[model samples]
Target: MGIYKILKTAILSLFFIVTVFSCKPKKAQNENLLLSKKNQLKKAFRYPNYLNKNYILGKFDYMNSNNFVIVPKDLSNKKIYIRKEVLVAFLKMQTAAKEDGISFKIISGTRSFAHQKRIWDYKWNSKYKDLPPLERVQKILLFSAMPTTSRHHWGTDIDLNNLTNSYFTKGKGLNEYNWLLKNASKFGFYQPYASKKEGRTGYEEEKWHWSYKPLSQLYLKYYNEHISIEDITGFDGSKYSKNLQIINKYVHGINSELK
Candidate 1:
């Protein structure tokens, strides 16, 4: 080939390669941005009614995800129900644990708003009497207050148990818990308020509280953004209380990490 033609062809080839490579990254970046935008939009408006009479704790909103499968009434020794995606992941985790002689079980899944209220009243009247009303409300806000705010109201959170005991406490370490820590993310699960991160969450470290990965991310984002003092009050307040004000300060001012 002529020298001029050879140089021209090499330049064109290089230009084509560079253009294609550059375009690929741009395409990927656009896709990522689009996905992030979608997530944000979903988070902005996806608030569940924690006080709805029909709200069932531990029961999956099966309509929300196509991957959900009904747990066999017989196989689930307990009446606990979970999202199909969560069940699949849990079963897989169980199978993997058995290989190492570990067994896993579900102790608590969902709770009705009424049930939550009862617990709240019991706890408040029995254990938190010494706390100022405002402080008590602030503390419960970190977790759930019956008929007002509860992740368990969403049916995506689960309280798992070791084979020996279901109630969670310090020194109740089990291989299943470790396995979940390492592998639950693969199936879309995470301990949202891990004991290690208690300071940030303002809640007790719950080793057994695992959320379905996908929905939890959405809920966390929503919980961060939508459940403002205003929103919580709107849900169930007869009058403004000091506790509500404290909750607002933390939720709106400090814990504003929602994406």
Candidate 2:
């Protein structure tokens, strides 16, 4: 009996030591990982300001800001703003595409909340005005984002070449589209609104819209975690935001590859 008791005590002690040591390391590792992620986000994006939904919602002024740069007139049709990191990647990609004889232009770029609001309001008060709020918003959402929920607000997305789908179906536009498909990812760009047939959510297939995944993906993660449909307000059809599942179905409903 004495021998058995000693063995049992020894086993219990060993088990306790193993459990304590194993649990402590796991806890410490998790804490360290969380701290690392926080630090990385802060160092890379300037923390809460850039990661915050207000920034994602286009509440911040990007004009003359160091973080944003003007798209050179040669690259875009009009004066447009784009994130510095995205511009760098795009410039590199543009050079490569130029070499390949597949040239494209930025038709649209960063849009502030006020700018997007103007777009939303214009369509809202247009012929669609007669429709129910939700239906009217739906019509706009098919192609446009409802102000605050737009990815364009992030400055990491752009519309390239032409806006029409048929434009990319053949000829020069098709060549550009095919080139983007073959190589855009090499520079961190991806189509966020691929065809529904690809199982992507949100807006219809916008062959023109390409996002800088490296930055936009992180911004999207922050937006999904922090922003809610209720946070979307100050627009004509703002009330319909929740019913439309704008946060989930629109803002979060990007290309899975992006997610």
Candidate 3:
């Protein structure tokens, strides 16, 4: 009887030891995975600095009415388009502007990927080639992108007011721009890039660009950390060879005269 009790106690002790040993490695691995996820989140939320080369201008693309907000008056024959969510925010902006006695209009929004390619080719082949590479890059960055790399493609960004009259210049008193800076956020809008700091951003300051804050903020967070220029420009054209050729021919070659 004594021997049986002693043997039972020994077996129970061995079982407890085996269970603990089996669990330790799994617990350690789980802790490591959680730590890795935490780090990724931290990186995503950091404030963006202009100096970051990743701060390339986002590409724009033309989307159908379903993706855009159409202002009835602005739709005059032309299909007026802006990001669906942005259009809603713009409506809010318009209401706020009305209260403040300021008028706001969307001068431009959403360019098709093909259209962007054309603008890029025109700028690159035209007078841009005469300038230094860095300068050329800067110039192009102002109004265009290197084919397929524009945020406007997402249909969530827009330029307010006419480019000619409401050009984004530094230190220009914000009489009009200021109204947006103060009120846009209330409508869930924000300027992703501003002109005050040139040393950091290779592109020119564009006060006119406003993003629907909720989406823009999320995009900014993801883009700042994970996206790369290669992802924007590298598309398999063969899948849509004809469309690609069209983009290459008409859109890219449209401004050949300037080149």
Report every candidate's CA lDDT: 0.58, 0.89, 0.57
Question: Sorted on lDDT, highest at the top, how do the candidates line up?
Answer: 2, 1, 3
| Candidate closest to the true structure, highest TM-score | 2
Models sorted by TM-score, best on top: 2, 3, 1
- Model 2 over residues 175-214: C-alpha lDDT tens digits? 9999999999999999999889856667888999999998
Q: Model 2 TM-score?
A: 0.83
Residue 82, model 1, lDDT:
63
TM-score of each predicted structure versus truth: 0.58, 0.83, 0.59
**Candidate number with the higher TM-score (1 or 3):** 3
115-204: candidate 1 lDDT, tens digit per residue: 566777765777676787766665655555435456666667777664222344334465567777787777667775565332453454
Off by more than 4 A, model 1: 1-78, 138-146, 162-172, 196-199, 222-227, 233-259
TM-score attained by model 3 = 0.59
Question: Considering TM-score, which of the candidate structures 1 and 2 is the better prediction for this target?
Answer: 2
lDDT of 1 at 259: 17
Among these predictions, the greatest lDDT belongs to 2
